[model samples]
Target chain A: MKKVAIFGLPLAFFLLAAVFLMRGLYSNPAERDSTLIGQPLPPFQLVDVMDEAIQYRNDALTGEVNLINVWGTWCQTCAVELPFLTQLKDQGVNVVGLYHELDSDPAFGVKSVDVIRTEITEMLKTLGNPYRFNMLDEGRRYSLDLGVTGAPETFLIDKSGKVRLHHIGDLNQRVWQSKFARLYSELESE
Target chain B: MNFRSFLIILFGIILYSVSHSASSVEEKFSFEDESKRALFIELGNELRCPKCQNQNIADSNAVVAKDITAKVYELVKDGKSKDEIISYMKLRYGDFVHYEPPITPLTLWLWLLPLIFILFGCVFMFLLSKKKQVDISQEQLQKADEWLDTK
Candidate 1:
């Protein structure tokens, strides 16, 4: 009994540690709950990417359920997912683009608005525009406020403007079916 | 070369490399108050970059890290306290933004597990020592005494 107890205790500990370490190996480090989930969209007054004269506020997105996609022309994944997002938009989903500009910093030599507009137009014309309207995230302050780590993230906002979900990577059919579709339907019903 | 001269050369090389790397990325932010500048640097060290998992905001070249470092500079310049800035970041990015994790129910085990392991080890060692002492019988003690006398 004593020998068994002595051997079993350490064996149990080793097994437990092995299981924990093995789980860590498979777990995605980037996967974490967003702090802004269940919170209202952060207040912002930003101009449209196409036309700076047209401004948008937090209330602009509150009237209905919307998918705010954080994307940039530079992001390859964003380009790849553009068609899928456009498909969602065509299927009566309100898809808004949050333009996460990379070269907004003056220190890094900022791009002119005309240049950015041309690039956006060229990209959207080629990839099919998924956005209802693109809000220019100048300096990426609004993106930062939205807890955005990088481009290619998407946030699902309900009718009341509460953030329902924040997905970090590209949104595809598989992701939509598994993560977004059911909850989105539930929100639509609500 | 002699061992001492080799070590000196190695130490000199290490020092030169460190100074060279430190001068490579010189971000100039002039502050009126030296203490605020220090605070800004301190906050940069404490704030973890969200995009790059392991690197601090100061060390990471990720765009998000640059945004965060800029924000930290702005907040520090605005005279926000350390805790206020930390909480502000926590609001946006959750507790993961900060290097020091709060001791919650889930994280409490991180602190408790080491103590538990030490206690168990102590108990196991105590039991083993006690068993060793108990294994010395009367005949063994008599034999030891005789051996000592002869010696």
Candidate 2:
């Protein structure tokens, strides 16, 4: 009984720790809160990908519900989400694409900024251009301010310029039909 | 050379190579003021990269970390105070971006768990030693009894 008591305490502690560890494994880190959600878009500006003359600022998204998608040509998932974005655009959903410049790594398959833009244009032509105007986040200053950890993240902004939702990962029809479309319509009514 | 001597030399070579490579690749950032430069370095060390999760912004090779390091440099240049800079990151990225998270009801467990574990460990060790001492004393008592019986 004494031996059992001596070892049992540590055994119980180990079992408790194991339970917590198992619970942690089930909790997805991606489901974490965006501190920027419900807050106004941070002051940022991005130049147009196609036209250097055009610039997009936080004010540009004001007075309209806009879906700001942070995307890059290098991200495989972004390419997959492109068609869905185009479909949303056809349905008159205000979708703005922020072209985050990936590093000039051969592994990413693109080399220069010019090539990236050319490829984006080509992709748009082939996949169908959904973006109202693609904004070039050249230095990723805007992306950093927007708290984008990776490419293919989407932020749904309300008419008041507040970010309604921030989603990380590829957005497809099911995502649109399930959460985003309903939320967008709710904001439109407001 | 002995196996032990070879292992020591191998460790030395690895350490020297790592330090040499680190020094060669380290990116240098220029700040207007000396204090601002210090602050920039401090911020880099303090801020955790959201993407890398493990590495600080200064050491992380991830794209997000690079942007954050640049942003920190920019903020320092703009004459924003350290608190303001931290607040800026916390506002966007939440508490995960800062190495030192604020004390709140939600984070109480995270802060107190370590202290609780230490206390438990101390008590466990104390009880373990006491039990060992009691066992030794019991053995000593048995030996004395046998000695007396034999006598």
Candidate 3:
């Protein structure tokens, strides 16, 4: 009985606690707050992947309604959505990208360098470098500021540099049709 | 309680059960070889379910992964090699499909952590065991002296 109480009870408590913690993380934020929507974009500088001497920063784009896609060459989901994002951009949707955690080796997970390089090259060939000026932040400082936890997350920053809309994961043709239309209407109203 | 009546009642129950059929949408794929099925599951457990992004295919609730697994069951039942199926999946979904993704220079830490932890645990356990196995010579001598005095 003593052993059961000592071992079983704590084990049950730990399991319950873990379940709750995961539940909380998965849940959306209770309140809808977009304080950053109208605020100036954060200052950041990153080395260009194409050239070592070329550095890109947010200072270059002072005021433009741009889409900053948080993506990585190593992410499979990012590759899945890359073509759609390019299509949207081709349709004249103002879009830029913060190549989150590029340049440096991925911190977690196991992926062969040869495979990753091949995938990235393929991605570049298809996407045709979507960013007006792409920047790579290995530490993910900018991504965290926008509350991005995953890749293929898209942030729509209006002319004022405030994040207007945040979309997570692959934006299919159907989703882009509706979402981008709404973005356009919102811009016209302003 | 009568034999004739009891048989009639049993037949009626059977007819009712047969009428209220459970038509499952689930596809039936049976395997003759136990080892192949086990291997499929072992391979399944090593692949991440694309729909349930965070979980291994075998551990996910995603119906897509379940469908893929059912397909794998069918193909394996039809006698496909393990390497062939794994390569097929990798081709379709990239290297992220592998649950324990191959350790590359970038992913060195994933492989290194377990080794480091085991080494640390061994050293810790060794020190703990040494501490536990104390020399009883002093305690025995003192107890013996006390016993002699009491006598």
Candidate 4:
């Protein structure tokens, strides 16, 4: 038994190290459990993207299950996911666009509201509009509050406005089915 | 161009670029007080950029980093303490936002594993030396002495 242990111990450690490294090779560095999961949506009162007259509060997202998609016209992935998001919207999923404006920074020269509206209208017209109504995250303050790192992130908010899931990449059918669909139904049932 | 002049030009360009990039971050965030400015800089160094892994928020030019920096400046101006600001960030972005990870059950292994490895290595080395000592008996030593005398 001592001889077996002497021979086997280093081999066991070698195997463990090999397994650990192998798992690291496949593990995604960008993927992390969101701290905001199980937390309610951050309070914000922002105007609509197209119409400044209409304002949306955090309470607007309550009373229904919704997907708050953080997207910008400048983001390529957002355009790619637009059709799929529209499909989800068509299927009765409450899809809300949290419009993340890239040029909102005054130092970098801010775009006029009319110019932004025109751009959004053009983009949404070309690609199918998924959003019931897009909330303009003015100066990206709301996105910061939501811990949004970049565009094409989605937050799955339940009926009570609690964020159930925060997906960092573009939303598609596979991701929806695998990540969002079951939890969505579960939240609906609740 | 001559080699010496070309080298000088290259060095000048590098210096200019470095100074230019440094000025960009400096001009963006400013505080009325020196302490607030110091706190802002410290927090920026401690906060990890969520978009770009392996870079602190101060070092990254990512939009998210800029947003966080802006927020940090706002909080500092509001008289929020460093711990309060860090916890506020942690609340939204998780422990990954900060450079110093919290000691938790899962992360405790990171600190413990290295110590455990050292302890095992020390034990193994001690046992190896003990085995060597045991293998060389007094009889073997006397035999070696006798053999040397005979030689």
Candidate 5:
């Protein structure tokens, strides 16, 4: 009884630690949720150029080749990637732009929300309208669901709402020519 | 062994204990920069490690916080800027890595609240201890009255 009293808590704690170690070893990031890829794209209601409504967020764009590009007007890298995104838009691909909170612009120094209006207006003025539709995420309500860390993340969502490719930084021509097109065709068949 | 020899042995033991304690803090993590090292150790003593709740990094047996503290020592040795080191730590381990509970306006209350509570507690106990019951038995009261008049 005395031995049990001394050893019980330590033994249980050891078991808990072992469980966590096993989980970390076996868990893979790719096996995460991909519901947004193949299903109806989520609603992203944002104000566009000339104060027009942009319906970039909807359930309709799912089960097709769609690119959800994460950007903010404040981020230098995102601005640099704008010309490349414009080219992808010209290719008749459904390139959807998800504006990060605080506009990702260096000037929109909110340190918090990089919302849609700032991103759309700023980019439209400089880079021209590369996106067929744009959504305003003023509060970044949906970004948390998208698993964003650093900005300029691009997720290639297939027709089934399954994410086929998740790129961290820029979406350059070399990336689209090699990886993006192949993934696009793969999703088309599915 | 004379009395002087015995005194010398006792003095040696005292010296050894002092050096041992200092060296333990040193051997764990040592830096060339004396001022930053002193600040790190002083800060380590005051700020409780979030990973090891009961103890600060200086006091903890935690491997993660210990590695971080050791890295802080190394950076201080290398003359890396303090702000850069702090931000690097924040990026790698999140804000919880900093033990010094940052001096924000909202957090001023965390440090102030407990200190105020302790001061009040001490004062209340002191005032309670000073309370004395009056000796109000008839003979005592008469004696006290007589003594007061005599004085």
Candidate 6:
């Protein structure tokens, strides 16, 4: 009995470890949910990229269901996801774009905010604007406030201004159909 | 140690110092208050970079880490207390952003399991060593010899 107790403990520990490892292997690293879910959206006031005179505040997400997408011209995945975002817009999903920092005009090799915004505007024009308006994230302070780690992420804000979901990759039909579509419907009816 | 081994250790020390000095040369935030600057540095060290999971925000060059360090500096300058800044970070980036995770019901076992396992191991080893070196009685030894002879 003593011998059994001695060896069994270690065996059980190894089994538990194996189970955890197997679960880790099967899970998607990107699917890890953000802790900000169920919390209110972080406060920020950023300028609209197209019109510097206009500012989009954090309150814009209140009283409505909206999808806030983080994107940048340099991110290739964001370009691929643009079409899906447009489709979501067509389906009547309110989409707001948050432009991640471009800091300097890459083409001109100078630190001109206007030139950088113009380049982003041109890029969006060439592709298509799914968002109501793309807000410029200067110095990425707004992104930091939102705990955004990188571009090509999206947040779902519900009617009451609470952040419902934070998806950490390019949004697509598969993601929408599998998760966000049902989630949106549930939140919309609330 | 041999001369070659001594030379290798010296070389390693030089390499480490060079890397350490390189990081020190990176631009640091300046503050009007020395204590605020110190607090900013402390906060940076305490916070982990969400993008580069293992690297502290102070040492990481990742964009996210840079942004976090900047925020920490700003908050310190704003006269936010250490606890408030930590809570603010926890709210935005979750428990993973800070080095110290709160002991919640879900995480209580995580915090306690190592100590529990160490206690169990110590007890097991103590019992094992005791059993191995236990003194045998003369009568028991005689009985064992007689039993062996009969076998």
Best by DockQ: 4
- TM-score-wise, the better of 4 and 6 is 4
lDDT of 1 by residue, B5-76 (tens): 999999999999998877755546668999998999899999999999999999998888999888988999
In the predicted model 6, the residue pairs found to clash are none
Q: Report DockQ per prediction, comma-separated.
A: 0.73, 0.62, 0.01, 0.81, 0.02, 0.53
lDDT of 3 by residue, A131-174 (tens): 66566654565554454545777777776666676666766777
Alpha-carbon lDDT of model 1: 0.92
Model 6: fraction of the reference interface contacts it also forms? 0.77
i-RMS, each model, one decimal: 0.5, 1.2, 14.2, 0.8, 12.5, 1.6
Which portions of model 3 show Cα errors greater than 4 Å?
A1-35, A109-119, A127-129, A188-190, B1-151
How many angstroms is the interface RMSD of candidate 3?
Answer: 14.2
What would the TM-scores of all predictions be? 0.89, 0.73, 0.42, 0.88, 0.40, 0.79
After TM-score superposition, the amount by which residue B37's alpha carbon in candidate 4 deviates from its true location, in angstroms, is: 2.5
* lDDT over C-alpha atoms for residue B105 of model 5: 94
lDDT, model 5, position A22? 92
Clashing pairs in 4: none
In candidate 5, position B150 carries an lDDT of: 100
For each candidate, the alpha-carbon lDDT, in order, equals: 0.92, 0.86, 0.66, 0.91, 0.64, 0.84
Question: How do the residues A142-172 of candidate 4 rate in per-residue lDDT, one tens digit apiece?
Answer: 8888889999999999999999999999999
Share of true Cα-Cα contacts across chains kept by each model: 0.85, 0.88, 0.00, 0.92, 0.00, 0.77
Chain A vs. true chain A, TM-score per model, equals 0.96, 0.82, 0.68, 0.94, 0.62, 0.86
Error of 1 at B64 (Å): 0.6
As for lDDT, the candidate ahead, 1 or 5, is 1
Q: Candidate 5 lDDT, tens digit per residue, B3-112?
A: 99999999999999999999986676766668877767665664445345457667776433455565666666777766777665554344455665677798898899
> Which residues of candidate 5, in runs, are more than 4 Å off?
A1-57, A103-119, B1-151
Q: Which docking class does model 2 fall in? A: medium
Q: Where's the lowest-lDDT run of ten residues in candidate 2 chain A?
A: A102-111
lDDT of 1 by residue, A140-189 (tens): 99988988999899999999999999999999999999999999999999
Q: Clashes in candidate 6: how many?
A: 0
